[model samples]
Target chain A: DTAVSQTPKYLVTQMGNDKSIKCEQNLGHDTMYWYKQDSKKFLKIMFSYNNKELIINETVPNRFSPKSPDKAHLNLHINSLELGDSAVYFCASSQRNIREAKNIQYFGAGTRLSVL
Target chain B: TQLLEQSPQFLSIQEGENLTVYCNSSSVFSSLQWYRQEPGEGPVLLVTVVTGGEVKKLKRLTFQFGDARKDSSLHITAAQPGDTGLYLCASPGYSSASKIIFGSGTRLSIRP
Candidate 1:
């Protein structure tokens, strides 16, 4: 079974269009994250939710919003997407250890979003 | 900001050749992780080193953490075509939160 899965493996939309990507994890992890990988292959953490509560919000713009309905699902919605929104969006989950602050993340295949 | 810098941004070598990639940082980290990402796929964690001056081995790949906990290295012996991927080094964010800071990554291409 795939531990982490993301829907819409590919997305192509025009500028100013809004889109959403869905992600689900079966690992029973407490924390889920949304990451953006640019064309340079630089991975950056955009948002993180632990047990359906927002924990980490990076320097991402307000256009990108992450919602976690439960511990197993975290979805990302982009409003009025622009050309700079083009990148591979990845969903990951981990069993967080607050004491140690270290965890192993399992990632999905990723959704490639291209904004024209 | 705490940053992880990986050396040899791009490497293309023939199969059977050994290679070593380095991840350095000025800030100390409690632990570090290594991940490999293949084309069209998300990164998969290979190993994690926690203690200073610690070393771990996975088949042909060996990972070492610096004594100061500020650097790490990954050495692959007799790299095969299957090993071709982008290797990234990451650490927990400076804050106590569960965020991870990933390095730029080293893109390795092994030709058969």
Candidate 2:
């Protein structure tokens, strides 16, 4: 089974449109994160939820918001998307209470977002 | 500014050769993790080093954490074509609110 899964592997939408990407993890992890990989292959953390509690918000634009209905699902919503939003978005999960050594994150196949 | 700086942003080597990728940071870390990512896929965990001067091996891959806990290195011996991928080193952010912060990543290409 896929430990972490994302929907709409590829998304192509016009500028100023609204879109949402869904992510789910079956690893029973306590923490989930959203990351953006730019064209230059630089990965940056955007947000994180620990047990559905907002723990990290990395000064992302107000147009982007993350929602975690529960500990198993984290979804990203983008409103009025711009051309600059084009990039690969990844979802990852990890156990929070484990020792520092076991904090390895498992990522899902990314969703490629293209804002035309 | 990026907290971690990775050397040799890109490397192209021949099969059966050896190569090393370095990740450096001035700030200390509790643990460091290495991940390998292939095209059209997300990165997968390769190894995690928590102690200073710790070394771990995975078959042909060797990972080393610096004695100061502020840097790490990955060495591949007799690299094969299958070893070609993007290697990234990451560590937890300095603040409790910040999650994991990834380096600039090094793209390794192995030619047969």
Candidate 3:
């Protein structure tokens, strides 16, 4: 079984269009994250949700929003997408244990978004 | 802002060669993690080191966490073509509102 999965593996859209990417994890993890990988291959965390609660929102533009209906699902919505929004989006989940200081995150295959 | 600088952003080596990728940071972390990512895929966690001066081995790959927890390294011995991928190092954020911070990433290509 795929531990983590993301939908819309490839998305190509025009400028100013709206799009969304869906992610799900079956690992029973409490934390889910959204990351963006730029052309330079630099991966940056965009948002994080733990048990459906928004815990982290990086300095991303307001047009980009993340919604988590439940702990197992997190979706990203982009409004008025710009050319700069073209990049690969990755979804990951991790189980946090109080006793351990570290948690291992499992990632999905990734969704490549292109805006022209 | 916490920054993880990975050295030798790109590496191309022949099969059966050895290579080392380094990840350094100015701030100390409680733990560190290494990941390998193939084309068109998300990164896969290779190892995690929590204790200072800890070393973990996975087959031909060796991962080390610095004594101060501010740095880490990944070394692969006798690399094969299957070893080609992008290597990344990351650490959990310092604040509760922050997420994990990833390095710039090192792309390794093992040519046959």
Candidate 4:
């Protein structure tokens, strides 16, 4: 069984179009995250949800929003996508422990979004 | 802001050659993690180091944490083609809980 899975392994859209990526994890983790990996291979945290509650909101544009209906799912919606939005979007989950401060993330195969 | 800097942004070597990659940060972290990402896939955690001057080994890979808790290193012996991937080091972001900040990554290509 795949621990973490995301839909639409590849997405090709035009500029100004809106798209959404769905993610699900069966690991029963408490925390889920959305990350953007640029061409340089730098993974930047966009948003994080801990047990359906928004926790970390980075400097991402408001066009991108994350929704977690429950502990197992976290989806990302991007409106008016631009050329800069062309990158691999990854969904990850982890069993979080704030006091111990150890987070080992399990990632999905990733969705490659191309904004033309 | 805490930053993890990885050395040798890109490396290409022949199979059977050993290599070592370093992850350094000026800020102290309670723990550090190492992940390897293959093409068209997300990163997978390989190991985590918590204590200062700690070392862990997994098969052919050896992970070492600095005495100051500000640096770490990953060494692979007799690297195979399967070892070709982008290796990243990460730590909990200083600004938020459960936020992991990753290094730029080292892209390793092993040619058979």
lDDT of each: 0.94, 0.93, 0.91, 0.93
- Superposed model 4: Cα runs more than 4 Å off: A99-101, B94-96
Question: Considering every candidate listed, which one attains the maximal lDDT?
Answer: 1
lDDT of 2 by residue, A31-99 (tens): 999999999999998999998999988889999999999999999999999999999999999887446
lDDT tens digits, residue span A1-116, model 1: 99999999999999999899999999999999999999999999999999999999989999999999999999999999999999999999998886443588999999999999
Identify the superior model by TM-score, candidate 2 or candidate 3. Answer: 2
Q: TM-score, chain A, per candidate?
A: 0.96, 0.97, 0.96, 0.96
Best by DockQ: 1
The order of the candidates by lDDT, greatest first, is 1, 4, 2, 3
- Candidate 3 has which clashing residue pairs, if any? none
Colliding residue pairs in candidate 1: none
Give the Cα error of residue A21 in candidate 4, in Å: 0.2
Candidate 4 CAPRI assessment class:
medium
> What's the TM-score of each model vs. the native?
0.97, 0.96, 0.95, 0.96
| Model 2: reference contacts kept, as a fraction | 0.67
What are the candidates' individual DockQ scores?
A: 0.69, 0.64, 0.62, 0.68
Q: How close is candidate 4 to the true structure, as a TM-score?
A: 0.96
lDDT of 2 by residue, B1-112 (tens): 7899998899999999999999999999888999999999999999989999999999999999999999999999999999988999998555544478899999999999
Off by over 4 Å in 1: A99-102, B94-96
When candidate 3 is compared with the true two-chain complex, its DockQ is 0.62
Residue B29 CA error for candidate 3 (Å)?
A: 1.6
Q: Write the per-residue lDDT of candidate 3 for residues A22-110, one digit (tens) a residue.
A: 99999898999999999999999999998899888889999999999999999999999999999999999987654334667789999
